[model samples]
Structures are given as structure tokens and as C-alpha cells.
Target: MPIQPQAAKYKPESPILSLGEKIGDPVHAADFPKAILRFRNDRWAEAVGLDHLNDDQWVQHFGRFQPLEGTLQQPLALRYHGHQFRVYNPDIGDGRGFLFAQLRDHAGRLLDLGTKGSGQTPYSRFGDGRLTLKGGVREILATEMLEALGVNSSKTFSLVETGEDLIRGDEPSPTRSSVLVRLSHSHIRIGTFQRIALEQNSELMTRLVDYCLTNLLQPAPEGVAPPIALMRQAVENTAELAASFMVAGFVHGVLNSDNINITGESFDYGPWRFTPHWEPGFTAAYFDQTGLYAFGRQAEAIHWDVAQLAVSLRLLCEAEPLIAELEHFPALYQDSLITHFFRRIGLTPGEREASLQFIESCVQAMAQTGTEIDRFFFDWRCGDPRSPARYAGEAWDKVRMEAAAFLPAGTRDHPYWTDDAPCSMHIEEVEALWSAIADRDDWEPLNQKVEAIRRMGEAHQPRLT
Candidate 1:
């Protein structure tokens, strides 16, 4: 058994915890007088102030979603391996996190609600599974911010400031620790399946595949063989995810196999950021010196990760079918990227090819000019093409001039292409900062932009070609 020695230690406790209880059905908001847990003058300690929480309080705050009908919430440690920076590190696993169990959300979606800083498990090899407050805040921002941007991502359901003190080597001495509860489709990753595949445990692999298919994918035809179908489905989901990241200016920071999910939703917001400028070599990870997972290389990185999954599955079946599915990645990602990019600029399917070409050219020019990424699109939502030309401040006029020269010959005819009127927003350097699009915080302006863009999207036509 190649399974890590401690792998078998993790198993769900008695009276399996269901997802329903965790979400707190018949949900009642906690009242001010209820005397709820509070972060001691600090949120990190107050959120998970389990010591202060009585049995009833725990039930009230976390009980409805607890799934288990008891005092102990037994966390299960998972086993898996991953390739960090293109190098295989079999010693890896949850090493820290645990699946609290699945939860059915208000929408009747089976969401896996897990905690990153719950506690140390067998896989916590030399490191604390505890999460810092900084990480907690970042994850919250990611979930709320990215969702508003129309990107599919794991949501931060709750941040229980575990009320405990932690010592993280990265930050200031004695970093505050808190539990970040994330709600997602499933916590299982490509690494989970890979582990079984590596062991050549076809039986376990088959069971795992079936589980993923039934839980992650929809009802399949009765007679269809699931393993191969599961692989194909994984390819499609992963490809779509890759495309979303590519078009959204998101660099996942880490594309490790353990981080990839069968559900294809973007989860685990670690060191993630929208590229500030269009440097193909820009990466979110501090340690990513070679930029293996750079902004422009995300598509390729994901494809490479998927290819690893494909090879791992080779033990159970021929490689050709898997290769075929993998081969479809580029096109799938391209279509997704184009769709997202079109939406960003309010392009619909009915738009003429020339119009789109103009938009693409404008985007390239803005990015090349090192313009902020988010504000540019947000400004475009108001139907301004030559808006950049009206910018009044220093250095901006130069960029505006460049934009004009970059515009295609007939772009002036477009309704948004202004010649006479200046850009409506103030011409301050702060305003200039917004024009580049990337500088605007992903949380702000993005939600408003999504709504306004949707309206334009209604009238908009996309590329017929």
C-alpha cells in the first residue's frame, strides 16, 4: 500500500453529518441579545470562540450546518499528492485542511463546506493547518469580489475567528489564527483521483470516479461506463476553468494538481491577484521565480496539469481517449475566453466582426500601454470608445494620443467613439489610475459594471463568425 501511513486515520464519525444542518435550515439570524461569540476586541478570536460557545450556542451558530447531531464534529483528513512548480511532491496532502462534510445550500446545491484552519490532522506535516487572519480576509475578499465579477468561485460562507493564537513563520511573530469556512461544490481534487490511480487501485479509482460523476456531474445515461466519461467530463470542466482564469486576468498563483477540482469551479484563493499590467511573466506567487504559472501561461499550466491527470489514469485504460479529450482543451478554453472577454466590453453575439476586432485591438492597446485593467472596462460600460482621449491630466494625454493612433481607421463611426466630448469622469491622476482597469480593486466597481454590462449585453450581438 503506497498510501501514506496516516491516510487511514481519517474517517467520518458516527451518525454521518449531512449538509442540511450546517446551512441552518429555517434559518434564523442571531439576535444581538443572544450573546453570540465575539472576537476578543479582535475578530479572529471571536469568530471561533468555541470556548465561549455553549452546546446550544454551537448548535445555533454552527449546528444547523453541522450535519452531525452530536457534540463532536470529527474532521476527516484527506490523502493526496501534487506537483508544486512542475515538480512532483508526493509528500503533500490536505496536510492541513479537512472536509467537514457536504452541505445543501438554500438553492438545493450540494456544497462541500470545509474549514482551512480547523485544526491539525495527521497530514499536518511539520506545519499548522491553522490559517492566519490575513488569509481569512483575503479569502473573504476573493469570494465576494470574484463572484461580483461573474467568475465562478468558491464562496466564503463563514469566517470563524478560531479565537486561538498562532505563530506563522511568514508574517509578524505570533500571527492570529482563524478558521475560514468555504462553501463549494466538492472538496475532492484531481490529486484524490491521482492517488488511487498511482496505486493502480482500479477498484478504489472506479469507486472514486463513480462518486465524482454522481456527485459532481449530472445523471448520465444508464448504460454509460463512468470512468472514461468521468475523465472526459473532467477535461471539459478543467478546460472551462482555465478559460475563465485566462479571460478574467486572474492568476491562480498555484495550479498544483491538488488544487484542481472536478467541479471546475475556482477555489482556494491563495496569493491570487488580477494582473496589474499585461506582463505575460507576471505571477502572484512570490516563490514563482520562473513564472511557470504566470498570467499569460495559466491556460498552458492548466492544460499541463490536466495532462498529468490523464497520464495517471493511463494505468486503468488506454491513453488515446484521454489524449483526445485533453486535446479539446485549447478550443474549449478559447471559446470561454472569448465569451468572457466579449462580456467585459459588452459585446453580444450579433456584433459585427469589425466591431469586435476594434474592441480587441483597444484592449490590446490599453494593456500594452500599461493602462489599469478594471476601470477601462468599467468606463466602457457607459458606452465610450474614445473615452480615453478625453483624459485631461498629465501623462494621460500621451496615453490618449497613443490610443487614438492605435484605433482602427473606421472606429470613429462607432456610437461610443467620441471625438468632441471629453471623458465624463474627473481627469485626476486617481481617475487615470482607473483607466488601466487592473488597478481598480476587484471588489469595487465590478458588481456595478456587471449589472450595467448585462443591460448592454441585452442589446449587444456577439461574433457570428
Candidate 2:
């Protein structure tokens, strides 16, 4: 069946407006010669009250940055300073994107409709602000795979192929262009606060802190300062996010402060890759020569970014409390890793020590056999008896026994689990998907891949709470 967009049913709200001067800059999207709607996440749109928008309306709102009714009149290109690769750069903000609107999900949680490749902004530096069609397609694949794996991630709400030929030194010249809209919990990054701290604007900092606390974080204790409460929440959320990435076998190439959102949902899919094995030094981005954001160092990168958030919070609170909050990251990360690992493997939670040992054994098994990451999870899920005999060795035997006791009764009844191969998003597969689109204009492969991923997600019912 051909996909069609439905009417606009927008319910807009704007809490970030409290930042006033720090909110963003007014900007318009480029006047592309055409707006070809390539992807529309109707499921997620329904959750955010946008399921009714027809195709033309979808292109108008997402492709042209036309504000939704009752939302901000003009798109706001948010301003912030970030530490890119450990170097502070003040001239960084929404170079190619802006917050288009804010809305609430069915659960009443605030969500942001943010754009990428909308157009050049004050922070565009010296380059054209447009996203390559390949980049947009890659992001859709990344988000879909990550979400299927139960990682807290942003949804690629819309992807429109804008009519433009872009020249880039990285890829083939005259590549197609696109505009992408991502639906996330928040677009506010740690760098947002860093910018206020850098300017020594204590009053604005206080307002921002309070606003975040009121809008984003859960209610604080009776008398704790909002900054302290927010710090603790950010630490836990960031730690959990890192654990999700580790368990999902995902390496987010860039872990800059600007890329780390305070809300803890993973976004900004740049050079991301899924690990094929237990290789620690598997870096995603080609320029990450130092392996600073490697698969193994992902947790460290997140901790460093969270610490930077704490440093910014210091502008409004004492250092000791924030330091204490930072100290919680290791334990938080470990616990979350174990929990998420068990969830991914379809095992009920076990004793902390036992779970950690089981994870270690699984890693060793993968290393010794060189099995694909997702294949391991798929085969061993719920301790399925059909896993390779070699995987039933002494170490894995113990894990199987432990996991069997907790396996859900109807595990094998699911058609997805019975499949011979697991859904994987390795780089080769990603490139193949793109090649089909670029060379043959065949989108069927991408559509089929998404359907398979969705089925995999459905089979693993009740995603991590």
C-alpha cells in the first residue's frame, strides 16, 4: 500500500521560550525547487499529535519550516557553545537546523520538533547548511535500528528529498539533498547551559535551571536546589543512555557536549556504527584517530560530557554536591548495562554479580567465536535450545541454566524468534540499502528492512520501562 499523510492535528506548547534571549534565532528554510516526501513516521506522529497532516501539509511544515498552529511564529535556531573533541568552540549552535515547534506526547511529556538541513543559520560558519540524501537515509536507518534494540532514541519523524545538488569533499560531488525532522524529548544540550555559564549570566542560568527542572526533570525534593536535582537526573539519565548504547552494540562516533542532550535520548546520528564483535577499539567516525569515542570508551565519553554539564551547573550551586552526583555514574552505568543486557537477551533480571558474570561470559563467547553481535543475542535469546552446540560450552551452560529458569513460556511461539537470521544494521548492509536507492531508485529494500526491524522490535514485547 502506498503511504499517505493524513490532516494536521497539532497541539503546540513552548517551554524553552523561557530562555528568552538564549532561545534561538529566527530562520527560514531554503527555497528548494522540490519537496519530495521520502519518509513519514506516522506511528510516532500519532503519539505527538501530528498524525493528521496530509502529504502537502507535511512538506509545508517539515520541508519549509512552516510553524504549526499555536506554535512558535518563526523557527528558532538555538544558540549554544560546545566542546567539540575536548576543545571549547563558542561559534557553535544550530548551524543548519532549528527548533521548529514543541508539542506534548500522549503521556504529557514535552517533545521538540527539531530540524536538520533546514538552511544556513548564524552558526553555519562558512559552509552551506544542507544535509546529503545519504546522510538522511543513514540517520533513518540508525534511529530505526537503535529503537528496535530498545535504546532510548529520537524518532526520524520526517525525511523529505529537497531538490538540490550539493558539492562535498567527502562524498561524490552533486549528491542529492534532504531535510530531516527529528522528534525528541528535548533539543537542549549541556552546551546550552555552558553558554550561559561562559557569559557569567547567573540570573539567566538560574532561570534556565529552573525551567529545565519544571519542564523536563521529575519533581525534586522539598528543599534541594533545582541545579542539584537536575545534575543528579542528568547523571543517571546519561549513564543509562551510555549503557543502552553499549548493550545495543552501537558506537556514536561523536560524543561532544553539544551532541549530548540533557533529556538523555540519543539523537544526532552522524558517524555511528554497530559492532561486529567484542572489539573495544571499534571507532565509528573515521577522524576519531584517538579512539576517544570508541565502542569501549563510549561510557567514558558520556561521563566526560556529563561532568561538563556538572561544571556548568556549578554556576548555580556548590561543587561538592555536583561532584557527589558525578560519582554515581559508574555504579549507575554498570547497573543499567546489566539490566539492559538482560532485557536485550530476553532474560529476567538476576543477581547483580551473576548478571555481570553472564555478560562477561557472553562477551568472551562472542570474542572466541567471532559471531555477529545481533546474531548472538538472537540465538541465545530466552536461552533458545537451537543455539549452536559450540555455544553450549561450560561457561555458556551456566548462563543457559540461569536464563532458562526465567525464560517466558511462549518464547518460541513468536515468528520473529524462529527466523534463521537476526536483523542487523552493519555498515555493509547500510551501504547496500543506500546503493539500491541511489543506483536503482529502488526504495523497496529500505522499506522491507524497516518492516523487518519493526517486527523484531514487536517480538521483544514491553520495551524497557
Q: In terms of TM-score, which candidate is strongest?
A: 2
Off by over 4 Å in 1: 1-73, 220-224, 350-360, 386-465
Give the alpha carbon lDDT tens digit for every residue of 1-465 in model 2: 002123334568988888886667888878888899999998888776788789999999998777798777888899999899999999999999999989877667788899999889999999699999999999999988888888888889999999899998878989999999998889889999899899988999888888778888786788987888999899999999999998889999999999999988899999999998878899999999999999999999999999999899888888999999999999999999988887878777667887787788778777776877888888877766464574756666665666665644226467998897888899999999999999998999999999998888777664555
Model 2 TM-score on a 0 to 1 scale: 0.95
For each candidate, the alpha-carbon lDDT, in order, equals 0.56, 0.85
lDDT of 2: 0.85
- Pairs of residues clashing in candidate 2: 6-52, 6-53, 7-52, 7-53
